[model samples]
Target: MTRTTHDTHPVQGPEDVSGEATTSRWQQVRATGDAGLATAEYAVATVAAVGFAGLLIAILKSDEVRELLLGIIRGALSVG
Candidate 1:
Protein backbone atom coordinates (compact mmCIF):
# COMPACT_ATOMS: atom_id res chain seq x y z
CA MET A 1 0.00 0.00 0.00
CA THR A 2 1.20 3.51 -0.87
CA ARG A 3 1.11 6.23 1.74
CA THR A 4 0.60 9.94 0.99
CA THR A 5 0.45 12.93 3.31
CA HIS A 6 -1.12 16.25 2.43
CA ASP A 7 -1.12 19.53 4.28
CA THR A 8 -4.89 19.79 4.28
CA HIS A 9 -5.89 16.30 5.41
CA PRO A 10 -3.96 13.59 7.24
CA VAL A 11 -4.39 9.95 6.32
CA GLN A 12 -6.91 7.96 8.37
CA GLY A 13 -6.28 4.21 8.64
CA PRO A 14 -7.93 1.38 10.52
CA GLU A 15 -5.49 1.94 13.38
CA ASP A 16 -6.71 5.50 13.75
CA VAL A 17 -10.30 4.34 14.04
CA SER A 18 -9.43 1.76 16.71
CA GLY A 19 -7.14 4.19 18.52
CA GLU A 20 -10.14 6.24 19.60
CA ALA A 21 -11.87 3.16 20.96
CA THR A 22 -8.70 2.13 22.84
CA THR A 23 -8.33 5.61 24.32
CA SER A 24 -11.97 5.76 25.42
CA ARG A 25 -11.71 2.33 27.03
CA TRP A 26 -8.59 3.36 28.89
CA GLN A 27 -10.21 6.58 30.06
CA GLN A 28 -13.32 4.78 31.26
CA VAL A 29 -11.27 2.20 33.15
CA ARG A 30 -9.24 4.89 34.86
CA ALA A 31 -12.26 7.07 35.63
CA THR A 32 -14.20 4.26 37.25
CA GLY A 33 -11.47 2.35 39.09
CA ASP A 34 -8.52 4.65 39.76
CA ALA A 35 -10.34 7.72 41.09
CA GLY A 36 -9.97 6.72 44.73
CA LEU A 37 -6.55 5.07 44.37
CA ALA A 38 -4.75 8.11 45.68
CA THR A 39 -7.03 8.44 48.67
CA ALA A 40 -6.62 4.76 49.43
CA GLU A 41 -2.86 5.04 49.15
CA TYR A 42 -2.78 8.03 51.45
CA ALA A 43 -5.00 6.30 53.98
CA VAL A 44 -2.74 3.23 53.94
CA ALA A 45 0.38 5.33 54.39
CA THR A 46 -1.18 7.28 57.24
CA VAL A 47 -2.22 4.14 59.02
CA ALA A 48 1.22 2.60 58.58
CA ALA A 49 2.93 5.73 59.87
CA VAL A 50 0.66 5.92 62.88
CA GLY A 51 1.25 2.27 63.65
CA PHE A 52 5.00 2.71 63.36
CA ALA A 53 4.90 5.78 65.60
CA GLY A 54 2.85 3.97 68.18
CA LEU A 55 5.29 1.07 68.11
CA LEU A 56 8.19 3.44 68.58
CA ILE A 57 6.46 5.18 71.45
CA ALA A 58 5.78 1.87 73.12
CA ILE A 59 9.36 0.74 72.67
CA LEU A 60 10.80 4.07 73.83
CA LYS A 61 8.63 4.09 76.92
CA SER A 62 9.84 0.68 78.02
CA ASP A 63 12.51 0.76 80.75
CA GLU A 64 14.73 -1.83 78.99
CA VAL A 65 14.75 0.04 75.70
CA ARG A 66 15.27 3.37 77.43
CA GLU A 67 18.22 2.01 79.38
CA LEU A 68 19.68 0.44 76.24
CA LEU A 69 19.42 3.67 74.28
CA LEU A 70 20.81 5.69 77.16
CA GLY A 71 23.69 3.30 77.58
CA ILE A 72 24.50 3.50 73.87
CA ILE A 73 24.38 7.29 73.91
CA ARG A 74 26.46 7.52 77.03
CA GLY A 75 29.01 5.07 75.70
CA ALA A 76 29.25 7.02 72.47
CA LEU A 77 29.67 10.35 74.24
CA SER A 78 32.20 9.23 76.84
CA VAL A 79 35.81 10.22 76.31
CA GLY A 80 38.31 7.44 75.77
Candidate 2:
Protein backbone atom coordinates (compact mmCIF):
# COMPACT_ATOMS: atom_id res chain seq x y z
CA MET A 1 0.00 0.00 0.00
CA THR A 2 1.20 3.59 -0.81
CA ARG A 3 0.68 6.62 1.49
CA THR A 4 -0.07 10.09 0.11
CA THR A 5 0.28 13.62 1.60
CA HIS A 6 -2.44 16.28 1.49
CA ASP A 7 -1.89 19.85 0.19
CA THR A 8 -4.02 22.02 2.44
CA HIS A 9 -4.14 25.86 2.30
CA PRO A 10 -0.73 26.42 4.19
CA VAL A 11 -0.05 26.96 7.87
CA GLN A 12 -0.59 30.49 9.19
CA GLY A 13 1.62 32.47 11.62
CA PRO A 14 0.66 35.19 14.16
CA GLU A 15 0.98 37.79 11.41
CA ASP A 16 -1.08 35.84 8.89
CA VAL A 17 -4.73 36.52 9.61
CA SER A 18 -7.80 36.50 7.38
CA GLY A 19 -9.49 39.84 6.74
CA GLU A 20 -12.13 38.95 9.32
CA ALA A 21 -9.66 37.63 11.87
CA THR A 22 -9.82 39.02 15.42
CA THR A 23 -6.43 40.12 16.74
CA SER A 24 -5.31 40.44 20.35
CA ARG A 25 -3.93 43.76 21.69
CA TRP A 26 -0.39 42.44 21.49
CA GLN A 27 -0.71 41.43 17.86
CA GLN A 28 -2.16 44.84 17.02
CA VAL A 29 0.70 46.63 18.78
CA ARG A 30 3.28 44.44 17.05
CA ALA A 31 1.73 45.17 13.66
CA THR A 32 1.82 48.90 14.45
CA GLY A 33 5.58 48.87 15.23
CA ASP A 34 5.43 50.68 18.60
CA ALA A 35 9.13 51.41 19.03
CA GLY A 36 9.23 53.80 22.11
CA LEU A 37 8.07 57.43 22.05
CA ALA A 38 10.19 60.01 20.22
CA THR A 39 12.24 62.54 22.23
CA ALA A 40 9.93 65.44 21.27
CA GLU A 41 6.79 63.50 22.24
CA TYR A 42 8.26 62.62 25.63
CA ALA A 43 9.36 66.20 26.26
CA VAL A 44 5.96 67.65 25.32
CA ALA A 45 4.04 65.15 27.52
CA THR A 46 6.36 65.84 30.47
CA VAL A 47 5.95 69.60 30.08
CA ALA A 48 2.16 69.31 29.87
CA ALA A 49 1.99 67.16 33.02
CA VAL A 50 4.24 69.58 34.94
CA GLY A 51 2.18 72.57 33.81
CA PHE A 52 -1.07 70.89 34.89
CA ALA A 53 0.40 70.04 38.31
CA GLY A 54 1.59 73.62 38.74
CA LEU A 55 -1.87 74.97 37.86
CA LEU A 56 -3.51 72.64 40.40
CA ILE A 57 -1.02 73.68 43.11
CA ALA A 58 -1.66 77.35 42.38
CA ILE A 59 -5.42 76.87 42.61
CA LEU A 60 -5.16 74.94 45.85
CA LYS A 61 -2.84 77.52 47.44
CA SER A 62 -5.06 80.53 46.66
CA ASP A 63 -6.40 82.22 49.81
CA GLU A 64 -10.07 81.27 49.41
CA VAL A 65 -9.39 77.60 48.61
CA ARG A 66 -6.75 77.36 51.31
CA GLU A 67 -9.21 78.75 53.85
CA LEU A 68 -11.97 76.45 52.71
CA LEU A 69 -9.79 73.36 52.85
CA LEU A 70 -8.41 74.27 56.29
CA GLY A 71 -11.91 74.93 57.61
CA ILE A 72 -13.14 71.58 56.33
CA ILE A 73 -10.19 69.77 57.87
CA ARG A 74 -10.67 71.54 61.22
CA GLY A 75 -14.41 70.86 61.22
CA ALA A 76 -13.88 67.17 60.46
CA LEU A 77 -11.26 66.78 63.15
CA SER A 78 -13.21 68.63 65.86
CA VAL A 79 -15.00 66.54 68.52
CA GLY A 80 -18.57 67.81 68.91
Best by lDDT: 1
Could you tell me every candidate's TM-score relative to the true structure? 0.55, 0.52
- Model 2, 1-80: lDDT tens per residue? 21223232223456656554434534655665745789999999999999999999999989999999999999999999
Please, what is the whole-model Cα lDDT of each candidate in the order they appear? Answer: 0.73, 0.70
Predicted candidate 1 versus true structure: per-residue lDDT over 20-76, tens digit per residue: 765765675666564335877999999999999999999999999999999999999
Candidate 2 segments whose C-alpha is farther than 4 A from its true place: 1-32
- Considering every candidate listed, which one attains the maximal TM-score? 1
- Relative to the true structure, candidate 2 has a C-alpha RMSD (angstroms) of 12.8
Which pairs of residues collide in model 2? none
Q: Which 10-residue window in model 1 sums to the lowest lDDT?
A: 1-10
